[model samples]
Target chain A: MALARWPYDDLFRLFSGQAGPAPRETAGVFPPVNLYDDGSVFLVRTEIPGMDKTSIEVTTAGDQLTIRGERVVAPAEPGASYHRRECDGGQFRRTVTLPQPVDAEAIEATYKNGVLEVRLPRVPERKPRKIAVA
Target chain B: MGTQVQKTEAGTQNPEIQVREKQAVTREPGTWEGPYFEPRVDIYETADALTLMAEVPGAEAEDLQTDLKDNLLTVSAKVARVDPRWKPLYEEYSVGHYLRQFRLGEQIDQAKISANLKDGVLTLTLPKAAAAKPRRIKVTGG
Candidate 1:
């Protein structure tokens, strides 16, 4: 629950026995995310299927990275009855605090097959460096 | 196979089995009783088929499996762990197999089922059987 306010924080909470709210909220948000650090890059991935790429918005401010999007629920057919409904369909906003300073100009995000991956390259000064000794 | 179908049919009618059937549909960590984590899933029905979408990042197409036995459909995948070389400073997300099973009703045509994976989401299409689909009958002499 340390990063509870963030989007991918629930994923971290899972390991500590902290639970997220029960599913089945009528106005629930969609798309769960995964955040990670790989030496020189920070990776943020979100699951959002059937969404138009144009609708998603990614923005960075100071040390926070925000992902906002809308999941449009398919309209119900005239006589269709749901046997199971688990997908959340609506607008959602999730922001995570970056662990380290990132190169704003070097960040790149790519969306493919329902998964959006945002790569944030670490700033030169923040990256690990090897020192030479005499 | 016949007995399995009978069990499936019986399971649908029996309230107890229905409860257990849905009981296995737990997502994430807290609610489930076992160590195995259930994949995030979304099941939707169209006019001809039911589309099941699951979020399983890190899983490649080759690592996924979709099995149909009796009236149960099981989707499972093996997600490889991150590179051991890199030490995790802030850790989250589990690395293991993603699993989930659903009891398919008589409406589904098991023979025509298909699946495909893109990025990380797995999509399965279960086409409805002819008898299960809505039909409009017309009187020839009317």
Candidate 2:
């Protein structure tokens, strides 16, 4: 994905000068994704821990695949106080552009152990055809 | 602070999700194949126990290991490697194992510590020792 300048660049810059290792320099858009191609299918994998499967939504349109979800963190027990809070809770939507056309109708998604894997089968015509020389 | 800004921004229609890059942990002098990330965690304290919740996606229950030596508590997990048949085309995040350690501040009943893993999150409940629990004292009139 071409690095589209994040809209919050300026907002983050304002506090960048304050101190220590400005939030993971390599950090990219939320729900960081990894795409893998294995001849017949392209797999998209992302980690969204502690999220309910019902809250996640996956959609594919043309060459664009979108993943939208809400992660609701359980509230601390009454009278309990936090010593440290790092995990974030909220809504996240990430749309990834596919490198090649895919069979959207055959797309399959599975959520296991907080990880979401979306399998997009390559269109039949798009797959490399083996040719025999005359 | 930073968290406040994130909260407000998340309320917007197209909120930008903050993706904190995984922090790599240093290993001792030995043969270690893959990378290990320090999972982000939330630690909370109640009157009876101290709870720690950690995010370790892709980790299975059987692969998780937790150990307490002295006052140091360590949590680690082994994640299965990606299938060899698939070739990565575009990558934004790296997958590997998880490891993290923390030192205890309050006295804990180590024998009663319990851990549970569900949907890629590990929750550990560390019960506070009886002596460590605060007691209400009544004062008699002089």
- Among all windows of ten consecutive residues in candidate 1 chain B, which has the lowest summed lDDT? B14-23
Q: After superposition, how far is residue A33 of candidate 2 from its true place, in Å?
A: 0.3
Clash counts per candidate, in order, are 0, 0
Tens digit of lDDT per residue, candidate 2, span A1-134? 31322224433453365333223233256788877778899998999999899889999888888888878889899999998899988777788777778998999999998899999999987567899999
Q: Determine the C-alpha RMSD for candidate 1 after optimal superposition of all C-alphas.
A: 12.5
Which DockQ value does candidate 1 get?
0.12
| Candidate 1 lDDT over residue span B1-142, tens digit each | 3454412334333211111011223465532233344676777777798888776656778878888888798888766555654433332333455778889775788889988886566888889989988788977994
CAPRI accuracy category, model 1: incorrect
TM match of model 2 to true structure: 0.83
Off by over 4 Å in 2: A1-27, A126-134, B1-16, B27-32
User: For model 1, what is the alpha-carbon lDDT of residue B11?
Assistant: 35
Predicted structure 2: clash tally: 0
Q: Per-model i-RMS in Å? A: 10.6, 7.2
What does fnat come to for each candidate?
Answer: 0.24, 0.74
